[model samples]
Each structure stands twice: as C-alpha cells, then as structure tokens.
Target: MIATTSLQRMIGALAALLAAVGSASAHPHVFAEARLDVVLSADHQSVKALRHLWRFDELFSSTVLMQFDKNSDLKLDDAELKDVADTIFSSLAEYDYFQLVTVDGKDVHMNAPSQVMTNFDNDQLIVLFESEPATPIKLAGTIDFGVYDPTFYTAIDFTEDANMAVEGLPSTCTRKVIRPDPDTAIAQNQKTLTDAFFNDPTGTDMSKIFATKLELTCKP
Candidate 1:
C-alpha cells in the first residue's frame, strides 16, 4: 500500500479491516463483538437513532494498528484512534455502517453516522457511532434492527458481555434479541445465495438469515 498521506493510511486501515472473504461462499474474514442502543423519540412513539459499539477481534485489530501507528509506537495513541474512527465513519457509509433496520417489514432508511468515537483496550480496537433514521420510524408493528456485513466478510456478533437496549421506550413496548445460529441459518438460506451475492460490494439483503438483531415490538 503506497500511502503518501495520513488520510491514505487511515483509508488503508479501513480497507484492511474490511478485507473481503475469498471463499466460494460468504465467510467471515474479520470478527467483532457488538452492542446497540436504540433511542426512541421523545414522544416514545418513534425511533430516533441507533448507537453502536463494535470491538474488533485481536487479529484484525493488530492489522488495523499496523496501518495507523505511524509514529512507530507499539500502541494506538488518541490521535491515531480518532483517525481510525473517522476512516470508519466515512468508509462504511456504503455499508450503512453495517446497520440493517426495518419496521413492519418495511426497510428503514439510515443516514450516515453523525459522530464516531474510538477506543483501544486490551489489544482490541473499538469503534462507536450513532446512525439516525432518515425519518423517525413510528412505534407500530415489528421492528428489526440488526448488524451484519452484507458481504459477510466481517462477522459482527452480539455476545452476553454486550447489550442491546432501547432507551425511552414506552412501558407498553417490548424488545428481544434475535441472534441467529449460523449453522442453522446457512442450512436454511444458503440455497437462496450465490457467489455473486457474497462477492458483490452492494449485495442483496440475503444476510438477514445470520444476523444479530434487535427485535422491538409494540402493542397496537
């Protein structure tokens, strides 16, 4: 990678973290633990935005640090972390920042991240961002808010250590995590997928079968 500027280095790092899978089928080339905070409108009748936190796996974190640690320091400094966050916020625009949102079976348009923050801890690279809906989604019927890599190059999972929460939700509302089992999802939906689906930069929405989702439902 011939990076002549700091911006180039940051972009290079983002590319490294987003390296595609080479498999004939979609497979994970990178991994991360994820958390989400779903914020509701002040009226509690609509969704405002989804705040995300993703802590990348050790191997990919090291690869990212290698690209951004320009000062020869062993660890990522505050400035380096900020650059990394900026890279993610910009580069991931095409990926919808890995967020998939829907209401009553209708797709919810998500705007680009409004803010980004980064932290490096215990040899991991963590990114935080908030993405707002193009328009507030009314609290009606079922809502599916999820995190997935459309290309399946990165497997973002929600583990017990992390949480998926809804803030300012109406007392009548309920929320649940819809974390799918990969093996089961593959068996059920792999037939609908093709090489083109896995390789396409702007792929179809076939990744929902294996996503870690937050399901929010409100009573009529």
Candidate 2:
C-alpha cells in the first residue's frame, strides 16, 4: 500500500508536469506568411490596427490574433496607450513612405470600442485603447513578406507606404516618410514568395511575381 503523503506528492508532481506540457502545446511553431496594417491618431492618442489582408498563396486557414504581450505583464493605461500610438505612427512615418496631412485644419480626438473586426476573415480582436471621437486618422501601406510561427519565432520583411490624414494637428509638426531600397525590397519580396510555395495549403508550388505590390487602407 502507498503512504498517503507519498500519494499527495505524486499528484502534485503530475500536475506540475501537465502544466508545463500545456504551456508548450499552446505555442504553435509553424511559420506562415503574413502582413499587418497599423494606424495611428494624429495627436498620438490611439491606434486603429489591421492585419493579414494580402496573402500570397493562402497558407493559413484563418487569421489569429497573436497577443502582443503573451505573458500578460504589460497592461495599458491612458498614457501608455498614447505612447503606443505615437510609437507606431512615428515608426511608420520614419521607416516607410507615408504622408501625414491635416484634416479640415482641426485637431480631432476620437474613440472607438476596445475590440475591432477584420473584413477578410471575420476575426475578432481587441486593441488596447480606443480612437478618440471627432479625430479622423487614416493609414495606407503594404507589407511584402513575413512569417509567424507560434512555436518558434515571428519573422517579417516588408515595406509600407502610408498616408496619414489627420483632422486637427499642427502644421509645423512634419511627419517623415521612409521606404526600403530596391535590393532589400526585392529580397524580401522574393523570400516571402518562396516561403509561400512550401507552406501554402494547396501543396502546389507557385512562383510569385516579385514585382507585385500589396496595398492597405484604413479609415476611421
């Protein structure tokens, strides 16, 4: 017969092992091609985000929202939300070819629900903050090639050319727009295209046209 204390210890050990296994299983390690579109408020107050609009060969069944902070350690406050918005907007403006224009010569603040939906896959997602009302901001661009494998690492190589039209912002504040050089752009496009051939669901390898471009548009 087994001692009661020994049985209890065995149960606890089993539980711990199960937990570790579950955590490992939760992460999917397969890589797939993806693209993302991120929009930001003119005053750097919030962001309107989108993703996975243009898939080269339809490798994924549905778009899944990979939690930005999978560990749940990073919580968003009012100030943090604004900071995130500013970071995204500024990053796009500096690294990509994007235009920021004032709307009707007014600084408009806006708000929306915490959650937003995608039209292509009907995927429901939550944004950390809402867009302020009366503030209209728009972003348009494209990402060429990227990969997201939950179990491993998410790697993406792409360029975006966006135009941000803001309702109320100072004219003196100018946003910079940057784009990739020809060689890097071509390489990213080719890598993305090649990856699709191997991972696409159809199992038939298809040659992607490196010259093709993807476009994204956001309106709020």
Candidate 3:
C-alpha cells in the first residue's frame, strides 16, 4: 500500500530541489519540457480535449523512477506504471496539472484528467495525460492555451514551435507562440519585493509574468 502522506511530500519536493540554480534566484527548482495537442471535435468548431506530454529533467526523473521501480529492476513494468500513474494523478490534483486554457479571452474550467500514463525515454521519465473542458468549447475569435506551473516553482518549457500542435482544425487555422518579457516588471520591484516575489511557495500570480502563451486563430 502507498503511504499517502509520504508520497505527497516526496513528489512535492519536485518544486524545492529538482534543479540546480543560484541562491540569488529562488525560482524554478523543477524543469520540464512539454507538448500540447489540442483536439477539436468533428465539426471543427468545438474543442474536445487536450493531450499533454511532459518529460521531466534528469534529476527529477531519476528520483521518481527509482521510487517506482519495483523488484529492483531499474525499470517499470505494467504494474509499476500503473502505480506511478496513480501517484501522479493523485498528487497533481492539487496543481490542476498546471494547465491553463482559454477561449475568446475567457478562462475555461477543465475536468480532471481522464487518463494518465508513465514511461521512460532516454533515461528520463515522461508523463502523458488527456483532459477536457467542463463542457465542449466552441471556437470563437481566438483561443489561448498553455501548460504551466502557475506558482513558478516548476518551470515548464515548450522547447520549440513544433511542441504546440492542433488536431482536427481546418486549414485556415494558424497558431503562434507569444513569449513575453517580464524582466521590466521583475526588475522594477526586485529590491523591495524580491523576497515575496520568489518565496511564494504557491507561486500565486508569479506565473503571469513568465508563463509562455500559445494563441490560435481560425477563419470564421
């Protein structure tokens, strides 16, 4: 049986010790490369679901894999994979899987992930899951979505343009990555607010200044 509290604490440490950085910067202890697959309904006017893939950094991957490696095989088999998936699903509930989605500038509430799976690739751990909106969302003037750690404790990086994908969209749809520079806001308040800015364990509003945004446009 899994020790629920122990599992939560261990996974929670991902935010405090996954990455090596300077003391001057208290942000981003965990780093992950992620991808987004937006699934549209057959009509091409409604979003049905979102499929996500996240590959964890080496330090974090090694720790998680070791914990889930039953039988000391240094690998996870079917049973082990299910165990890891369950643990992740339970732990991530608190973070909402770090996903933010919007349609026409309005925030969309997502249902809990319907599926979660675990895998190993090139010595790193990968997690995949699919989630849908509370209700299917109709395509409006524009849609915006992203995978992120709102608390800034985890740095989710979408490495390239190809990491963002749209499926079932009409040929007229186009997407773009909008990377904003928040240095000015951070710098202006650094001296007086540095402690509160980086030390907020929950990450609160800090993500607004750093989260990468993906925008989609489709011809009406």
In terms of lDDT, the best-performing candidate is 1
> Cα deviation in Å at residue 38, candidate 2?
9.2
TM-score for all models, in order of appearance: 0.82, 0.23, 0.80
Error of 1 at 115 (Å): 2.8
What lDDT does the true structure give each of the candidates?
A: 0.75, 0.30, 0.74
Query: What TM-score number comes out for model 3?
Result: 0.80
Candidate 3 regions with alpha-carbon error over 4 angstroms:
1-25, 184-202
C-alpha lDDT (0 to 100) for residue 184 of candidate 2: 66
Candidate 1 lowest-lDDT run of ten: 9-18
lDDT of 1 by residue, 61-111 (tens): 887788788897888888988878777777677777878898887788999
Give a tens-digit lDDT track for model 3, residues 84-145: 78888887787778788877777889999976888889988788999999999777668888
Question: Model 1: number of clashes?
Answer: 0
Per-residue lDDT, model 2, residue 192, is: 68
**Local accuracy of candidate 2 as per-residue lDDT tens digits, 1-220:** 3233322222111222223435322222222223333354545433333233322212221222112222444434444334333433332222121111123333223332333222222332222222233433443222222112211211222344332122332333333333446576547677765676468522221212212223222233
Q: Where is model 1 more than 4 Å wrong at Cα?
A: 1-25, 183-191, 194-204
Candidate 1 lDDT: 0.75
